[model samples]
Target: MATVLVIGASRGIGLELVRQYRAAGDRVIATARDDEGMTRLRELGAEPLRIDVAQPASVSGLAWQLDGEEIDVALYVAGVIDRGHATTPPTQSAFDHVMHTNVLGLMQVLPQVMPMVEATGGVFGALSSSMSQIGPVPGSNSWLYRVSKAALNMAVRSARFDYPKARLVVLDPGWVQTDMGGESAPVTVEDSVYGLRRVLASLGADDNGCLIHHDGRRAASW
Candidate 1:
């Protein structure tokens, strides 16, 4: 069975991924920041790790936790959103909180995990958003969130050069029904994860460093 790692799996897309991967009989090592989230992962048959990606000290211990295993799939799914638009300036604390969780956290995790992925010629997927696209500007409702995901997209693509053995790609999961997506979202969590898994499974060397949509389409532009 493939060994999968899902970071920030407390709820939403991350948690659903753990559930589906475990159901497929893959060995899953999933992370969350609290006891409650740990319990949920355990119930779903995942090897749970406590990881607060927002805190550097907490993330620093990840390498030791997964020292020798070859990971087939590693996903960086931790992120926080900011709803404030460009009409008003975000406070320093707001910017830091969003950037630290969305961009900095993944940057810290990559060094610890990419080697494990490389050992198996694995796929490393980071959850990004189509809203992050700059070519066709979307609405400015969540401008800070847009900026952070755009940065995340760049971070994964740039890091792909260093770990050539691993297929690194950013995933846009679409607007799903979750706490973050709220009640009006059209996509379901199950559908999004299913499509993401299909896309990841089909990735080849040529697809590396690309942004993939949930429906398995490679993005034409950023």
Candidate 2:
């Protein structure tokens, strides 16, 4: 079984990932903002630690805590979505905060977990959205969220090259019906995560730079 570490394991895609990994009998080092909130993950046989991805101190502390643990898979599912555009002219604080939480956040997160995966010759995965694709040209709205995710995709691509021995999948779980995706999205957490697992499980060293979607298909720009 693989040893997996998931940051932002409190709810939504992060929470679902913890459940699926445990159900598959993989050992998980799951993290959330609080112990009380992540009790479900603990009950499912994961060791849940408190990690708020927005804080660099929390993430760095976690790196030290799991310094020697060989992690087979590390999934970064912690992301923020602020839907507004240049048209709306969002407050400076809101725009920057969203970018900080998503773009700058992912940059900080990857380095801390890379050592764990590198130790075991393992893989890494990070969630990106279709909105992030500059090639596709999304309709409207989601200015900051889309831009941050697009930058995240670039970060994943760069990491893929840097960590050539390990397989890295830059994933888009689709329009999932989680809190972030809301009720209107077509894909459920189960459907999205299950499909994503299949895609990740099938990857090899050559798939390191892939930007994959939930249905086992690769993204257009990938």
Candidate 3:
């Protein structure tokens, strides 16, 4: 079975992914910001880790804790969506918030995690969003989210080229019913994770640097 590391495994899509992977007998290492959040993952058979993705030292500390263990998959799910009117404080704060986790936090983990993933010939995934499209938004009110995710896609692309040996995947989890997405969203966490995990399980090295979606289709545009 594959050994997997799931970032942001506290709840919603991340938690479901952890559960499915563990149920399939994968040795799962899951991380979140706090003990309370990690407890659910613990009950689901994943080794829950306290990881604050926005902190560079926290990531390095985690690498130290693992002690050179090789992982078959490393999925970075830690991110934030800043909902605002594309105006003052809220948008500004949103930009900073999203960058701190989605971009800066990713940078911290990517350098360390990508090297380990390449060493083990593992799959490295980063959660991206269609809202990041340079084209136009399907809906309003997610301007900050759109910008941050677009930047994230670029970051993932860079990692793809940098880590040629690993299956570097940039994935859109779809508008799932989660805390960030709201209850009215069409897809469920289980549905999105089910498709995503399937893609992860089956991806080949040739698929590296690809942008894919929760439904197993290649996402169009950057």
Candidate 1 overall Cα lDDT vs. reference? 0.94
How badly does each model clash, as a count of residue pairs?
0, 0, 0
On the 0 to 100 scale, the lDDT of residue 169 in model 2 is 75
Task: Flag regions of model 2 displaced more than 4 Å.
Answer: none
How far residue 165's Cα lies from its native spot in candidate 3, in Å, is: 1.5
The residue-by-residue lDDT of candidate 2 on 1-222, one tens digit each, is 999998777888888888998989999998888867578778778888887777766666877778689889898888888888768877888876777667776788777788778888888889998888887775668887888888888898888777655777789999999989999999999999898888878886667877898898777673
- Between candidates 1 and 2, the one scoring higher on TM-score is 1
Each prediction's Cα lDDT score? 0.94, 0.83, 0.82
lDDT of 1 by residue, 1-222 (tens): 999999999999999999999999999999999999999999999999999998888999999999898999999999889899889999999999899899989999999999999999999999999988899876888999999999999999999999988899999999999999988999999999999999999998888989999999889999
Clashing pairs in 2: none
Candidate 1's TM-score reads: 0.98
Candidates in order: C-alpha RMSD to true structure: 0.7, 1.5, 1.8
- The number of the candidate with the highest TM-score is 1
Instruction: lDDT winner between 1 and 2, please give it.
Output: 1
Please report how far candidate 3 places residue 100 from its true position, in Å: 0.5
| Candidate closer to the true structure by TM-score (higher is better), 2 or 3 | 2
Give every collision pair in model 3: none
Estimate, for each residue in 26-142, the C-alpha lDDT of model 3 and write its tens digit.
899999898788788889988888889877778767777666878889998988887765554554555676788888888778877777788888898899887877765676577
